[model samples]
Target chain A: MSIPRWAWVPFGVALALLAVPILGLLVRAPWTRLPELLTSERALDALGLSLASCVVSTLLVLIIGTPTALVLARSTGRWTGWVRTLVTVPMVLPPVVAGLALLTTLGRRGLLGQHLSVVGIEIGFTTAAVVVAQTFVALPFLVVSLEGAIRTAGGDYERAAAHLGASPTRTFLTVTMPVLAPAVASGTALAFARALGEFGATLTFAGSLQGVTRTLPLEIYLLRETDTDLALALAVVLLAVAAVIVGLSQRLRGAHG
Target chain B: MTQRLALLVAGAALILPLAACSPAPDGPTVFAASSLSGVLPGIEPEASYSFDGSSGLVDQIAGGAPADVFASADQRTMERAVSEGLIDGEPRMFATNHLVLIVAKDNPAGVTGFDASLDGVKLVVCATEVPCGAATQRLAEANGLTLMPVSEETKVADVLGKVVSGEADAGLVYATDAAGSDAVEAIDVPGAEDDPNTYWVAVVKGAAHAEAARAYVDSLVGEWGDDLQHFGFGPPL
Candidate 1:
């Protein structure tokens, strides 16, 4: 079937808007110095911290978000809508606002934080805060994606397994989980990418300390103030990582289909 | 359906040009450092302002962001802009600021003074890239103390925020920031008085509103001294 000519105008405009900046970045990136820049001590530290924290946060999203997604998908109640909205709040909030919210609730003088400080346990400005901020921003992506998948998969298979004398836990582990593996993988990838790119919230809530909370995005931002070439190089690295993850996830989904 | 589409297109065409027009009747847009957050806006209530780290502002101006005037927290950044041909003329000194050790109003950690003993204390300071952070490093060196900070924020306001929030026991911020916040109390660092952080202001090269930009700079140089003083900034050297 031939597509309408007017539709091509808007589609082309959208494609150009998205592709221009990416093409600009590619053209301006310092390809020769990329290796040296990526291996710099500060760059390595930020990359290491970003990788470690994002991994931890992705794992956290998988564990906590999976159960939450399951509940949201299976349950039917007025309160469930509110719960789902609350879970997705961070996804919609500006990262800086999310950071401020986290700070007010978890900082030393924060409501619960002040009480916790009495026991001499502090989480602000630490690596742990980085994980918390990343998880806060990334959890919604995992929950929303997985919940949609769970709803699509439905309960017929689980019901059949239960009718066959399989326990609910066993059925979930063998039947439901296997069926949802592709969704879980795609959700995990999306959450991992989101966590890796987290900047404002981590900088505001966790504070940018080398070897602790300064992730690659923060490092790129700091470098942008001083060295554009190095910043562009680091940005290319982030873009490459994101592209790889997205390509892999698409391939996985395609294979499943 | 076509009528609605035409109306929508017409509305967007009208609004797009309006958005592209210059900033409203407020005088020329001034990109000033965050340290001038309090005084710049108050002095030039009619002028538009963008306050952020001096280096970040320099980067923005260098990348061709449109601004009539640029006010930097340190001379080095202004000089850099001048060297890069981003500034119209020689940047002039406008105001100076001194570093101070600020603790939460309650002084929970009971920080006594600027000493090496602060190594054990939880402190926050601006990252070395920012003007405040660079000044902090000079002060630390002048005093011969190796300070270990729990966090190095990108901006002085963030450092002040951490201290005010009691997340950090102490922070090194401008005296002006300390003066503005009752939530934090300033502790005088002895040698900090010697290494002052001077501010610079200049008109941007090829500014769209050159007359307004020069007038804005003149206003800052002429009668804003008292305003700066009111904001806890030191007189221009």
Candidate 2:
């Protein structure tokens, strides 16, 4: 059945709001001059860095954030409320502050950094620092989304499965996790996209060295150095990459459903 | 049903126009260096502002951004802005800044002097895209050092951040800026003599608010010159 006209208005308004940015993107796409801009060195370094960091960060989130999600999902104490809030801290923190926090905790002079300095190992302003900054921000998005799914899957599913003939780990790996597949895909995709576009923290902590720490956002920023058309061109690519992730997420979610 | 529908319709009406464009109040557009923001309120230029890298401001002006006034962190950028005819007349050099090698008060690598420097220090600088970076590069090269910076930040503040955050052993930043931060302490090297920093202000061409821009430029000459110099800039024009 069709939704009522008035009810559809908010949806329409939301679409309009979203459309404005897309329209600006299209209007300023630098379409005719696309080929020359796309192949430039800054474009390549940024695109590579963006991809590498997103991949590494998504891997880290899945590795570390999943266990945290599991713990939060299973716990129902009153502290869970506060824990839930804490999980979202990075999402709200300004990217610059997040970078500062990372550096203070892990830079060469950082609390841990001073110790690592003896070993001659430094973390900040490196490619590895880029990964750390991205993971710091994106992990929360994945964790929160995954925890919600794990909660919805509920203990009952696992408990009954355990009684029937499955181990707890087996039930989690098979029935519970398979059922939560759609959420996992969606969360990972969201986290990946966020990691890809992250700028301030990366610039602050990773130290924008071309072909080293210079991610796509930095490249786009650096693009304003010589060419706004190229900057606009980079923006177009960023939009495209984001759109692809969003599309893949939807398609995979549809399949999972 | 009617109440829900009425609320939705009213909400849509209110948000639709609001999202498109709000009414704007009038103001001149002063494009300035991001460093200027640290003390913009004191000068009270009669305009709205978009503060960013000194080079970014110069680029925007050259690219025909609708800026009425331009203030930059160093002579290189302001001079270039004037050369492009993006600025109207002789830009007055009103203030000076100095570069320092800042470290976290805790100090990591125990970096001391630049003339004894090499390409290996964990240094940070403003990218050559901005004027501070340009000044930084000049200073490093002048000291007979080849800097292998860990990062090249867009703004001088970010370079300072590298030091404060302990990301780098040292960063080249404005001494006045280092004074404002608890995260960093200045290490003066003997070679800073040749790299005296300066700031220049100019009215942009095709400014819609020429009168305001002129008044602001005039302020920089004597009275305002002293204020800038008080902030550790060199002597007034």
Candidate 3:
């Protein structure tokens, strides 16, 4: 696994590019005020909201996305391409555009939202809207990751269980799911982390209120205007959380391999 | 082959900074608040513009963003820059804007100005970090009303968008912004004139085109005053 000598230069440059920003965050962080900043009411509210919404969104992603992954992995029809493309759309679309799409689809006067509002139900600028936006953006991570894992795990064990007098659902529950569990865990972790870092779409679709829709990223952004020290401290907290999630996901991936 | 690849990478590294440092050929780079995004280009079509929330612009300028001139929607933001010595000289007041309550064209919530009809309505306003938000707060206080906004958007434009989209029953945005958009109808806020936000312009401390920056600021106060008034900005008091 010896790396080419010429590649080292470009690789070194890439590593430096990634390392410098993290180093900058570490260096510029207000270490002295971090304790007070994180303990502040604003910080706590945002932190709690971020964790709750992210958890709810991740659960929603797992419940729906796992079946979607299974179907995509098994299907061979031409429409599968379209379905996969639709699933991956949020991953490529700008976060703000994803937010706008969500807004237009579920806003008070949005496509279906206009009808919903007639029934006195509105999704826009609510905590539920925050979850919807997060789920929209985070769905692809779980679906894509689990789809690849399902494809790699293949149909052998499922076929064996089916032949041994097991029902399709029973085979999936007993054999298929266990085999893909590690991948699912990693994917869920990745999706949860993505939801945790969601800012633009949530801001656009859900709007920002202290305890309602302002997640840590949105709080950090608003604070940057009024208090850079608090912003930096919160950013350090977000960075640490993201780092831990990424590490855990990587370990899950290693376990899967 | 490897040598050629290494040389190509080295050449790219050398050229990238030069590419970034290349100035806009015809005009100075102007950083103005998001509220001015609509009219600033119309007023000074030649200058390259970076439009954002004024407080965000202040942070960027402080962080060494490549800005030649800076125009803020309020005095407080400009004063912060002045206090931090980010400006080359004292910023001059160029224009003024006051908060206007905007609603969907049909006014679904039956919002008529800032009256009791606003009670229990899904109202939005700019976050207090930006200028319009500050004025909204002042207007609310001056009139002795406690506004309960459903959301506090960082950009006034977002506030307007929410109202236009009918996600919000009403929003507080700049008078000029309301005037610029046809999607929403503006309702005058009582005593808004008393809490008007003044626009301030200044050249950055080490602007690449310092003379052009100063000229732009001069024109905003001088020739562009009429244009500002036309676009719903009040003449500087």
The predicted structure with the larger TM-score, 1 or 3, is: 3
Better model by lDDT: candidate 1 vs candidate 2: 1
Candidates 1 onward: DockQ, in order: 0.36, 0.40, 0.45
> How good is the docking of model 1, by CAPRI class?
acceptable
Top lDDT: which candidate number?
3
- Which is the leading candidate under DockQ? 3
Fnat for model 1 comes to 0.40
Model 1 spans > 4 angstroms off: B1-20, B24-26
* Model 1: chain A TM-score against the true structure: 0.97
Per-residue alpha-carbon lDDT of model 1 for A12-43, expressed as tens digits?
Answer: 44555567789999999999888898899988
DockQ (model 3, Cα): 0.45
Q: For residues A1-257, could you state the per-residue lDDT of candidate 3 as single tens digits?
A: 97667665666566556777799989999999889989999999999999999999999999999999999999999999999999998988899999899889899878999999899999887899999999999999999999999999878888989999999889888899999989999999999999999988998899999999999999998888888899999999999999999999999999999
lDDT of 2 by residue, B166-198 (tens): 667778888777867887878875556456767
Q: Cα RMSD (Å) between model 2 and the true structure?
A: 4.6
lDDT of 3: 0.88
- Clash pairs, model 1 backbone: none
Please give, for residues A146-207, the per-residue lDDT of candidate 2 as tens digits: 89878766677788898999987898788877788888888899899999989988887788
Across B122-226, the per-residue lDDT of candidate 1 in tens digits comes to 899988876778888988888898988988887788889888877888999999999899999899998887789888899999988899999999888876456
Chain B superposition TM-score per model: 0.88, 0.77, 0.88
